[model samples]
Target chain A: MLVAGEHVLFHRARGFGRDTHGASPPTVLRHSLVKRKFFRLKLQRERTFAPVRTLYNLNLRQSGKMSEKIVLYYFDGRGKMESIRWLLAAAGVQFEEVLLTKREQYVKLLNDQALMFEQVPLVEMDGLQLVQSKAIMNYIAEKYKLSGKDLKERAMIDMYTEGLNDLMEMRMILPFKKPDEKQAHIGVIQGKATSRYFPVYEKALNNSQYLVGNQFSRADVHLMEATLMLEELFPTILSTFPNLKAFQGKMRSLPTISKFLQPGSQRKPQPDDVYVKTVMEVLNIQIP
Target chain B: MLVAGEHVLFHRARGFGRDTHGASPPTVLRHSLVKRKFFRLKLQRERTFAPVRTLYNLNLRQSGKMSEKIVLYYFDGRGKMESIRWLLAAAGVQFEEVLLTKREQYVKLLNDQALMFEQVPLVEMDGLQLVQSKAIMNYIAEKYKLSGKDLKERAMIDMYTEGLNDLMEMRMILPFKKPDEKQAHIGVIQGKATSRYFPVYEKALNNSQYLVGNQFSRADVHLMEATLMLEELFPTILSTFPNLKAFQGKMRSLPTISKFLQPGSQRKPQPDDVYVKTVMEVLNIQIP
Candidate 1:
């Protein structure tokens, strides 16, 4: 199970091989070479013995029933689940995806069984539920060996990932309200961006091509997500920071991210997209 | 040196045997005990580690300082530095408290040092600067063994501490403004208190005595400072929440706290006692 904010996702076994009607149960099956490598990566990153053992025990409980694999419970567009989804997809890991569409359905599921958050984007591995977007993203990244190899580089990844998260929370999440109020809020955010945040990122980018290390890591993924949102969501504010714009361009040009840019892969804009639209309108910029 | 937001503090060494200034060069510190413990607690709760050793090593630099102890830099009033101060006091640790009185001074310091935030409540220990209040608090708590003895209890401490910090940021920090906007903002904060935050605390308090364990951990200190502020700063909103009132009373009645309440401890009301005055005026209640 995984919980972030008010969202919770859980995985339980139906039987051995079949997908259960109520809750999906764990399965024991042979993994692909990539999956095997992912599992080794997870083991290597986990330092504590207790929780690792607990996860192992959970897998053992369903060992004889079916094949072993990972499962995810998530909401489509809330919190930090999107990055986790991207990480899993990038790593080529196949897992069950359960999307909770309605709030009522979400609450009912919570009442029937234990849910981490009252909301989605939770990953249930073995029996344990993980919450918090950073935690989930880092976990999946570790499991996939997507984080940088060395210790210092890894710290940089954590730092940049966290920095991106903080930036999004301040820039996008909190200010994402009605149109007029959002505009006012964005003005404040823009001021800070010009004065504080953008300069920091500009300095960071000047120091290295990537936020953290030589190769792309979860930090890059998070930055890509934030910058991509700005491309659609807050274009006007985004225009002030040309370096940030270039950074976004660089990230989207990456092979893996470039694949995601195919026409069909783009998600339809939500009602909240108006905020982004307004930002662009204010900035007089067009979305790509 | 540690930086959280706009605050910075430094821990510097005096001569051996005699405590005096200008004896040695100061080192900068990043992330406090509270922040580290919070991160660790999040990692533990998630049962995931992405380069755990990297985080551990980043944290380890705080331990090797030779001469200095902890020094806090922040604004006056129990804003960000309260928890760190309380943690040090609880652990019987020594620290220097430096208050940044003006915004210009803060910006000057930041420009001079390239500090992360031109803010307050930063701690410096053994020449390193640590930022983020939760990080600082947890670091001190861990070093002194004040957080918790067991893992589960420690996690609970983190949960409550994080919640309280969220509350403080929402209540105390965001709404505060120049005197001209104070009245209107007070009403907004009052509405939020009555409509949102109060109920959450009431529900949480119904189940747990302390935020986490039986012992008075840093969570309690954080809760105490926040609740105390609400009582003083936004009394009108607090009036509806009797359980919260009783909780504040319970905390204030503790022997250690009672001593601080006596005449000379600086608990007396001052012009800057926005938290205290607001709560008192709104709730029409007095602390014994």
Candidate 2:
């Protein structure tokens, strides 16, 4: 399901001893690009950096192998894919991206029937072409068992996640806003977060450590990702909500999430001018 | 969470004996609204609108009773609440809508912290205040076992539902379009449905009786809803897609769905000028 020759595995291993999680020692998943064929991976013990060895290029879903990498299809920015990236990272799942750089690159995907709605942030996982940010996250969360234990808990998680998504969406479109209007847009995000959205989360955190259910779930992961995004915009965004502040620290300290925060991880930076311009040109559309 | 004084159960009985499913005879659920308190309902055999008697003023969630009606909070329109109405109707689950007419009504809900993101289409069910249309729909679908039985099936259902939602959203905004520009908007919908969306569903239907799993699921319900929506715009919208054409007919024949499609049911009409004006004033914002 990958656009040929455009695959690059966003490996978590910063080539050797990085942030190690509990219990299992980290194994490096090194993937080599094979055009529209199969995903080849070599599992190297930490700091091995062995010769380019080829192991089974097995289908992750077909083999029911949790260790194999997932493929993400999207443009080279953080519009919709950022949350997908967040969930995957939180699950400690390694993934590769087919970053569409040209209009033709995106259109080929359309012609291939790879995108259900002709939109990106499509993840090829468990033998399915996953689209829609919420759907993608829901699948990943359920796969990782971050979605709750029962139907009611999952429902609560979905509700809280949806609310956090509303807040994240306000910040997500900032890069697309006109430069002259950017400050006003930031003001809106700050105001909404402080007066409305943050207060809700703050109150929820007061009752439980996680947003939904007693354990960490998709809602908590989303809140953490959103918290980091908001912090990047205004460093003091969570200053008034002490619960959120403490929640932010606790979230950053999670083993998988902490690894994602490192310097060379797959997390894309805020949309720079070039990234935004490229997105505008490649999509050839304007968001109203 | 039944808001005081505004609860009216939308029962599907055209006074009983209307449409029967399988071997099970239809029973009538009659509701009487109580101010600020509880939902009181009486169960009667078909054709009996018995004298008002008080049953348990049940909290539907805590009592684990599925027969009790769910309460929906939204403006009296088919904006985001329409899909909800569709799912509930398809499940044969009766619901009451607290339709907001004034700006202060919505503002009061905000002040009361009923709306997590300051938006409506909130459903008060199972002792929880649920916001966000997708979350609410997912909860309902899962609770009614309309969502797929397994993770992969659920994922596929989610993916298909998301695609259909994209198409529905395009039509959803038409009510807000300028009166002079309405035709152009309709044209856009027709073009997108025939070109981008309908074909996908048509192809998916070509594969199975249902969109995701072997049985009826949320995706199937959404497709049925969207098909009805598109047909309203252009009668021949599905003429080119035989699978979808057949799918629509098959879906409407199901007992619950057949009842929902009946006239005098809770299915909302396309938003009128008054609905649009109230939405604009009550929300007090402009989209882009």
Model 2 regions more than 4 Å off: A1-68, A286-288, B1-68, B284-288
lDDT of each: 0.45, 0.63
lDDT of 2 at B34: 18
Q: Judge candidate 2 at residue A92 and give its lDDT.
A: 87
Residue A210 local lDDT, model 1: 74
Error of 1 at B271 (Å): 8.6
Candidate 1, what DockQ? 0.04
Q: Please provide, for model 2 over A1-288, each residue's C-alpha lDDT reduced to its tens digit, 9 standing for 90 to 100.
A: 011111110111111000111111111111111222231122222221122211222233446653344777666667778888888898888887767666555544544556675556777766677787778888889889998998788878887887676667666656655565567557756765775568878998995788876888888889998888899988987888899989988888899999999998888888787876666545444232
The C-alpha TM-scores of every prediction are 0.53, 0.77
Q: Give a tens-digit lDDT track for model 2, residues B1-288.
A: 001111110111111010111011101111111111221122222221122211222223446553345677676778778898999998989887666665455554554456666567778777777887888998899899987999888888888888777667657656654455567546656765776578778888886899876899989999999998889889887889999989988997899999988898888887787886776555543222
